[model samples]
Target: MSDKSDERKRAARDRLEQQRELDRARERRRRTLIVATAVVGVLALAAVVGLIAANAGKDDHDSQAGPVATPSGATGKDGLTLQVGADDAPSTLTVWEDFRCPVCAQFEDAFRDTIAELADSGQIKVDYHLATIIDGNLGGSGSLRAANAAACAQDAGEFAAYHDVLYRNQPAESDDSFADNSRLIELAGSVDGLDTPAFRNCVEDGTYDSWVEKSNTAFGEGGFQGTPTALLNGESIFPKKGDEEISVAHLKKWVAEANKGRKPATAGATPSP
Candidate 1:
């Protein structure tokens, strides 16, 4: 009987020891899991912080990227207007255009000769305002790049010719070919005395990029609906003036009536568009 009692006590002691060992193992695993979770949380927080810092650096670089270099002889508000006719002409024709806008290209194609005749005859002065709405609407920099290149052409005293050239070689609405500086320089070769080192450097360096940005911003603030916004004497007259559809004859008649008794500008000769 004594031996059996001793054996039972030993068995109970072994069972209790085994349970204590299992409890210790569970505590160790819980501690390890908590440490692992804390480590993962710390790593995740560090990654987020690193990403924020990187973005902040990029923002700083972008803010100080380019200088606001306005083209020479730019007139009107903020020196954004590129005038293309006699300064003292009787009527003022304000034109807002985008390089990538097909409608603007169509308008130019339809009225280029008439508008040039009017401008050259000192009947009206054309105020050209460049915009980059297409670049904004589409996900590309073609409009901005082409506008800058045109501004560079303006600096070289070939704005009218270069402007016509750009329209003549304008790409499709979805095509961003104008973003290539080489292509812009290549186009400049067609203009007389326009494909110089200065012009190339200007296009390559994006000298007028900030000016283009400013012009785009102004376009947004002007409450204008879209590109090819034409105003004669501060009144909208694009597709139609009042009741009459705009035509070549109508344009001449309107200018004639506007300048009824007034004499045409006798100032210096303006470039033919």
Candidate 2:
């Protein structure tokens, strides 16, 4: 072959090889794209499944029966009386609580079971007085809204259930953590037989404003300095300074002492003169 012909043939072969390499690179890219798409699809499916499982768990735990009144007659100074235990119960225990207070939450958890047991056994009656001392700290009107919503819930006969849910979902003490009206209404809907429409309307219109204000005033007048303040048989049950632990033993001792000569007062009963 002549030299020029040989050079032309070599150039043709080089061109063909380049085209083949380009085809292979395109194929590799296509395969990579396919694998990436499959991985993304699997991840999305996993996330959806996780969300469903979480929702199911929450539903199971959130289902609770309505309030169970243990029935005793005791009324606060504000004329807000609750039937706590049996009529023959020896004494009454009153707890003033703020929904947004962490200390109140701790005290509730510590003494709730004991109080419930005593109420169940017809040994004592318990009344929970809701107040809004933490309103200023919670930024929004969450403290007032929650307290009002609770009263509305109580009116609908779902107070205990609503109460439990409120504490369970209480946000941290910060401006952003305040529970809004919508959130309160949403929580009210979780309780069985709770009139959602009525609850929402009441919350929006601040229907319980007067009632909440009265309770707040009564709480202040009753000499409660802070949230989680307790009273045994209508007298302040002051825990010793630094003895913040409201253990079962201490509570039982207090109740026993309070019941020595105490009698069950009537509902809406005022404090003794």
Candidate 3:
């Protein structure tokens, strides 16, 4: 072959090699895109599954128990009362509670049955002083809103039912979980005999603000610094942690001892020991 022909053949071979390299590069890019897409899809799916599981857990926590019964015609100092137990009960059990406190919820769940039993037997009266001790800008508004709504419910003669719902649907200890005024009205609607319009108006117009302030002041005067504070017959009851689960026996003993010196029909007149 002539020299020029040989050179032409070499050039053709070089061109072929360059085309092959280009083809390989394109294939690598396509494979890389496929792998990246698969990784992204897997991450998204995992995130969705995690979210579902988290939601399920929260639901389980929220739906754990049935609604507790509220007592009737339970009264307190300053006419700030709740319909928690029997009207003619011999003794009074006063509870100081903060709307935003979780321990109060636990205490409610633990003692609700006992309160119901005593109230039903006409043996005891329970009074709740709803206080707003949780303050600050984050979600303090919710605590204020709920306390005000509770006072409004009391004004409308549906305090017990509304109180039960508040404890039942109490939010976790967070700003977002605090009950707003709108949410308070919404919850009040679930009570059997609650006057929705009156309750809403009272809440909206801040008619119950004075009552809430009174309760808060009472709490301060009563020396209640934290939530879930209880006074049996006016004597402070200091509940230990985990007391809700295993402390009923102790409470019963205390009640028995407390009732020994008093006459059944005239017990409320006597101060608790």
**Highest TM-score against the true fold, candidate:** 1
- Model 1, 1-273: lDDT tens digits are 999999999999999999999999999999999999999999999999999999999999989875578888788888899988888899999999999999999999999999999998899999899999998889799999999999999898789889999999999999999999899999999999999999999999999999998998998999999999999999888888999888899889888988899989886355432
- Model 1 misses residue 87 by how many Å? 1.1
lDDT of 2 by residue, 1-273 (tens): 699999999999999999999999999999999999999999999999999999888877667522222212325544455445555577877778888888877776776678777776666767778788888654566777887777777666666678778887778766424357888877776788775677778777777666676777878887768988877777766453234445788777777766667654333222221
How well does candidate 2 match the true structure in TM-score terms?
A: 0.61
Collision pairs in model 2: 70-85, 71-84, 71-85, 72-85
lDDT of each: 0.91, 0.70, 0.70
Ranking by lDDT: 1, 2, 3
| Candidate 3: tens digits of C-alpha lDDT, residues 19-50 | 99999999999999999999999999999999
Worst 10 residues of 1 by lDDT: 264-273
| Candidate 2 ranges with C-alpha deviation above 4 Å | 1-75, 81-83, 175-179, 238-245, 260-273
Task: List CA RMSD, all candidates.
Answer: 6.7, 18.0, 16.2
Per-model TM-score on C-alpha atoms: 0.75, 0.61, 0.62
Q: Best lDDT goes to which candidate?
A: 1
